[model samples]
Target chain A: MKITFPHMGNLYIAIEALLSELKFDLIIPPPSSKRTLTLGTKYSPETICLPLKLGVGNFLEGIELGADTGLMVGGRGPCRLGYYAALQQEILYDLGKEIEFIVLDHPKEDFVRFKSQIIPLIKAGGVKALAKGLALAWEKLVAVEKLERTAHYVRPREARPKAATQVLNRALQKLRHTNTVGGIRKLCRQECDHLRDLIDRNAQEPLKVGVVGEIYTILEPFANLDLEERLGYLGVEVLRTVSLVQWLKNNLILSSLGLYSNRWLRINARGYLHASVGGHGLESVARTVALAGQGYDGIIHILPFTCMPEIVAQCILPNVSVDYQIPVLSLVVDEHTGETGFQTRLEAFVDLLSRRGQGGLQHDSACISWS
Target chain B: MTAPVYLGVDVGSVSTNLVLLDAHSLEVADKVYVRTQGQPIRTLQRAMAKIARKNQWQIVGVGTTGSARQLAGVILGADVVKNEITAHAVAALHVEKGVQTIIEIGGQDSKMIILRDGVVSDFAMNTVCAAGTGSFLDQQAARLGIPIQDFGRIALRSRHPVRIAGRCTVFAESDMIHKQQLGHSLADILAGLCDAMVRNYLTNVGKGKEIRPKIVFQGGVAANQGMRRAFEAALNAEVIVPRHFDVMGAIGAALLASETICREGATRFHGFEITESVYQNHSWECQDCSNQCEIVDIVKDGRIIASWGSRCGKTDSSSEYGMLGAGN
Candidate 1:
């Protein structure tokens, strides 16, 4: 059975590595674009989250390419994201495009069901395939984490415009062509080193801004309009938000081992937030608080326009801002948001940060000054 | 020696406003408010012509803000290209003393900017729906065969305004028609429309926002006394409207430009002669990738000055035109 999954930033990269090891024919849908969103919206419920609409579009595109089976990840929560899989299946079936919709949820709780679902792909490779496939995907995921971190560091200080972003993109593209773990690590290191060398050492230190938001919107360039890189271009260092690797570790690996909750989310977030509001609401608050504690100059909290979880977090964020006195800009984006307005807000936010970082406004000396 | 002045231009989807500020006094010397009519370059020309006719104002710095900022900035060689948020905030602070909240309702969009100690704290804008903005008011005014200018005065006469739902324009329009069929008084119906718009604005644009007192209202819709009253009645707070209420965005842009110019050495303003130049806009499909974006190129004097509408950032206007440097 050929496998297909919706793209969320670089998740497809690691997923492709695992599926390749399992020796399954796969249809990797084309990258998410305006066209993809148009098709997705055309078939989706009007008020559904952006990721759902885009996910449905990916499947439709995959179906057009002759792929029958769909793979999606789910969560148990107050957020609407938890119910997308079932809703998507219903939506697809109503459109007369019936196919196997395999949903993997709560990895530790449903390991048997998860293994059973993907058994067809594993059996296609060989007896020793499962272990090798997991390792391959894991190696790539780790390399990507390193790569994304290095890119965030190097982007603002790069001697040439887009140098860091270009190298990161090239490195990811190179990793896709290779098959081995060593190859992946070597390419990532090489690209990171090359980007490090291109950093303008003479250039002054950059303003540090922490990007905290919903996972998909924070990571996906299309959804957030390439926010991290845009900040980098404005000469601000972006502390990239959560990666899928971290998510996997927290939800799948740690929870599967019977851990009650993520330590950081439970401990660091306790004073600020009461409970896990689901869909990263508590996590967003926790991360923002942590970033503020770490002496970051600014925090940008982004989420889908209609995201209820983030809205709850957004209301409480002012208290965090009042206590810490570190500026936080909360941006709510939908498909209908205009680029000019989005870019303007970013520019204005950066200006605010820079102004705050200067003229004796910051008494703590903890804030990073814009050079 | 000619006295230096700052030029600010706010180019929106519906209108273009130009403000000239004296450098020392920080007072507006000349102002031009004109309908854009889907032709920003030409509309700008008319505004510039009017400003230029007054005197030879030595522009030390120029700033552009609004939806068409980049386009207008590229054409005029503005020193600072600011967003509507910053510009609006700066302008509100200039006129209103200790403004805690700012309500800006323009033609197509409505926005709420919250400020504390002269720094913008939070902001929210509603552009997706059209029930609460000025265009909706304009449409209802046209349908009622009443001049938009008289809408506010007539609405204030009603003792008891009927309640009308104003979530979306489609629903609001049908509801208004239904109210008309019920033989409701025209003034009452007008008052209801104002009430509904205020309700829609508070829910849609002002959601999750802390709307504190010392509220400053601006933008074209601020011209309506009915809206001002609606806001005051709803909030139980007096909304302060500035002297240059309709052109605050432009004034803010000018103020920001003046500040930037004093700090920076040189200005990038292309000068009044840009008013004479004819700019042509054209669009073509970029088939370089699967996402075929329709790129719009603005041509000036047989040369393509700028190109946009591509998500991938393939078309570089800086290298092609080299106009951004020529001004400096």
Candidate 2:
């Protein structure tokens, strides 16, 4: 059976490894492009968030490439994300396209169904093979993230801007062609070191900005307009609050084991937000608070436009900003987000952060007022 | 020839503004505002032509800001390129004493800037909605068979501004027509429109912010006295209009350029002679795949100087002046 899934920044690498190792034919959706966004917007609900539209767009592109079985992640929550698969199915059916869906939900409640759905795909190899395949896939995941982490650290510090980017891209291209797990790990290490070596230790300590926001927008570069890279290029080091590994640890490993709550996020967000308002609002609030206390030069909060949880979180962020005395710039991204305006605000925010880091208040804090 | 000057250019969809500031005094040496009329390059050229004829000052620094900032920055080799928000905030901070808030309305957009201690603290720009912008007023003025210049004076003559929906453009237009059909006075309808625009601005763009004292209103729409009165009545505060209200973005760009040059001690300011050169735009469908992406080429002096609009960055030669290409 041919399988396909939505793209969420390097997610395809892990999934592709798993499915291909399981001996199932797979179709990887092309990297998201403007065409994908346009198609998604054309078919999606006017008020639906951006990631959903982009996800639907990915599914369609996958279908065009002859992938019949669609895989999606589901959750029991107030977020509209859980309904994305059903809605997308309905949309595709309305357009006379057919693709079967398998939503791997919280494995706790639907373990039997999950086993039944996956057992057939892995029928070519038994449980032993399945376990091995997963192990290798997990390794690939770690390798990809490790290289990314190294790139992030070195990109802004490199004397030659864009040097780390070139290395990372080339290394990724190498990683994609490698077949064995050991090969992938070796390549990842070599690439990571190669990227690290590009950093100029003598370069100035660049301003560090914390990027915290909705999960999908944070992971998906298109949604945030490559915010991390842009910040890196602007001589700013970006420490993102979310990543696939962190998401898995928080949602899958920790939560499933009943030891999942983020201590710092919870403790910091105590007076601000009490419960999960759904769709990463709790996480966003907690993370922003944590970043503020940790002395990040600034915080960039990215939320897809009209996201319910983010909208709720946005209302409370300013209070956090005022209380912590840290500048927080919240950007709401949609299909029509003007890149020029977005870049302008970012540049200005960077300028503000740079100036503020140098102690903007010179009157000895005696005359600072919001008025 | 005069002392060295810093040139700032703001190229928006509706207008192109150029401001030349004296290097020493930091005072406006020359300023020109002209209709963009959909041709950003031509508008920039025209604006520069006017500035060129008026002065022979050596340009020490150059900056560009606005929607078409990249295009203008490319054409002019701006030392710094910023967005309208920062530009507006900088200009307001420079001109207005202890400025705390900035309310800017342009052709199709409006933004609110909140500043504390001469630094921009928070800001909001109208996103894809033109209900509370200058173009809407222009449309209403044409529909009402009244000159836009007299719109504010007529609104002041009204005894009351009939309540109108200030939500979306479609709703506002229909609501205005409905009020008109009900035999409401033209002045009352116009006044209601102004009030509706202000209400729209406050609710959408100015939501959740403290609209404090020392508020400065600028941009193309600031000339509408009716809109000014509506703001005063709504917030119960005075709104100051700067002398260079509409050209604040240009002025801010100049200020930013000046600051950059002062710190960096270098510039990429192309001379004013570029104003005389003609530039052409070209586009063609790239038959690469099913997407058939349209590649746009900005030609200068018969050279395919820059091309973009492709998903894959092929046929895109990152020219020396990266600012000129449609890099998006």
- In terms of DockQ, the best-performing candidate is 2
| Candidate 1 residue-wise lDDT, A183-301, digit = tens | 87788888889879879989879899998878889988888877887788677898876778877887778778877476767676777788888888988888888889998999999
Tens-place lDDT per residue, model 2, A1-371, is 67888888777788877777788889988877677898888888989999899988998899999989888887668889988888888888887887888777776656777677776767867777788778777888888888887877897788664678768867876777777788988999888888889989898898888887798898877677777777776778888777777777777778878887667666779999888888888888888888887878888889998899998888899899888878888888888634666666777788777656665543322211112
How big a share of the true inter-chain contacts is recovered in candidate 2? 0.16
lDDT of each: 0.81, 0.81
TM-score of each: 0.91, 0.92
Candidate 2: stretches off by over 4 Å: A262-264, A361-371, B1-3, B265-267, B281-299, B302-328
Tens digit per residue, CA lDDT, model 2, B280-299:
98989888654455677878
Instruction: Provide the interface RMSD of candidate 2 in angstroms, 1 decimal place.
Output: 7.2
Cα error of candidate 2 at position B4, Å: 3.8
Clashing pairs in 2: none
Question: How big is the positional error of residue B12 in model 2, measured in Å on the Cα after superposition?
Answer: 0.8
Candidate 1 Cα deviation (angstroms), residue A232: 2.3
Model 2, position A317, has a per-residue lDDT of: 90
Q: For candidate 1, list the clashing residue pairs, or say none.
A: none
Q: What is the lDDT of candidate 2?
A: 0.81
